[model samples]
Target: MAEEKSRDCCVRHKKREPDQYRDMINRLSRIEGQVRGIKRMVENDAYCPDILVQSAAVTAAMKSFNKVLLEDHIRTCVVEDIKADKEGTVDELVRVILKLMK
Candidate 1:
């Protein structure tokens, strides 16, 4: 049942501003590159500590990305939904926040 609900939500979409979209895509691209660098480091037999540092950096970058996206969602999607009388959006946002926390 939970999976079905999640799937239902997946069918909905939001149109983001062009600048916001571009910024998110750019951040993801950088994170992707960082991940690839880390992979190369492993394949090249780099020192454990050095590879760990790069891994930590990628984790931090992903967290930063999530923060920006969450802020934008609250500022736009959540606000819009609430204004439209969609109280369920609050519950959805809470669920998402909890998931992110984990």
Candidate 2:
């Protein structure tokens, strides 16, 4: 069942390089920890301002993650697709960037 799930995921997603995958995973782990910390703070009645600051930090971390992912996608996926004359890739990329910017 686990192997089947993995295969299903891979079928619809790009296979990242080992280093890129590791970096993305590490960033997500840290973000996950940060979110749990914020939840704990809320449960423990942390000062409102302090919680807000931590929330902003989480937002920044998320933006940083998105920036890294977008750069990698453009460098690898976008470049490869464009080279292969996939015009739709450009449109797809534009739509994605627009959504991200929003």
Candidate 3:
């Protein structure tokens, strides 16, 4: 039988407080709506340049959000783990970054 590992390795960093989370959620929700709008534009055969511009906007929004999350992870999870000398944490972080690049 495969041994069960602790779930902490997969745990997310401590989340921002409720208000902050709500703000982030609201921003993401708007981005989601924008993406759906882009899909509808494509379905309706909108102008190519217009669709391309909207697509670019969505990509930028997603990248911005990802950057914020990555910064938070580095500040909270990575910094703490490194300070405590937790084995393999840095390697795990590097692997995650490589996956993100792809």
Candidate 4:
């Protein structure tokens, strides 16, 4: 078998206002930094409680990120889908909520 070459892709499908885009990206970047900090704490033998606290922080940050994104999706996608008579989006959102709860 020949070597499987990897290809790079630039798929820019999601369109958001500049401010919204910046806000979401900035939130994710902060969460990424928090995750890296947790990795460093683990590598350096940080206290278990301290690490747990930091882990909780990361989890909170992720939850906040999800909340923001979900709000945006509901505000734009869900609302637009409803307006456009695409009722499936509501069902899709219910599935998403169930998945999130689990």
Candidate 5:
């Protein structure tokens, strides 16, 4: 018979708290504005270097957002499962880390 999986071992994981979600949404909203601004800059024939700098800022903001979410996941879901010795939890975490690195 196939081995049973832990209850928490699934593709979908726990969600962030409302405050965290809101923070992410706010960051994304700013990024959306930045994207629109980039389009305007292109249309107005703005300096290429300025546009590249703004694009870099947007990328940094997105990476910051991702870091926050990853930290939360490690502190909450991954820690709890690892402490409890949940089946395949460590493996899953390692896989996620590898995927993120790539």
Candidate 6:
């Protein structure tokens, strides 16, 4: 009932299993470190193309992280929402996908 009430309040926060939470946090931590490395490269006057390559690597890593999270959302949140017959979950999912595509 509390979960439903929260959803009705339009502030749904999915409860991630511990393992999933840890994995997501690990990915974000790696990305944060990569960003810090890029900042150091900039401060040290690293070559532009080399910096660009590293930037691209960071972008790819971020996309990979998004992919993992999206897969989990579909497997867990979307599945649970649909099973519960919560209204507009599919539409909300569509909006999210569209935003991601943009």
TM-score of each: 0.88, 0.86, 0.80, 0.83, 0.74, 0.87
Candidate 6 lDDT, tens digit per residue, 1-102? 999888799766888889989988998999899999999999999999989998998999988998898888999989998999898889988998899888
lDDT of 3 by residue, 78-102 (tens): 9998999888878988998888788
- Two-way lDDT contest, 2 vs 5, winner: 2
The backbone clash count of each candidate, in order, is: 0, 0, 0, 0, 0, 0
Q: Tens digits of per-residue lDDT for model 5 on 65-99?
A: 77887788889988898899877877887897788
Question: Which residue ranges in model 5 land beyond 4 Å of their true spot?
Answer: 1-10
Comparing 3 and 4 on TM-score, the stronger one: 4
In candidate 4 the C-alpha lDDT for residue 57 amounts to: 92
- The TM-score of predicted model 6 comes to 0.87
Lowest-sum lDDT 10-residue window in model 1: 9-18
lDDT of each: 0.94, 0.93, 0.86, 0.85, 0.84, 0.90
For candidate 4, what is the lDDT? 0.85
Of the candidates numbered 1 and 6, which has the greater lDDT value?
1
Choose 2 or 5, whichever is better by TM-score: 2
Worst 10 residues of 2 by lDDT: 8-17
Q: Candidate 5, which ten residues in sequence have the lowest lDDT sum? A: 1-10
Error of 4 at 39 (Å): 0.4
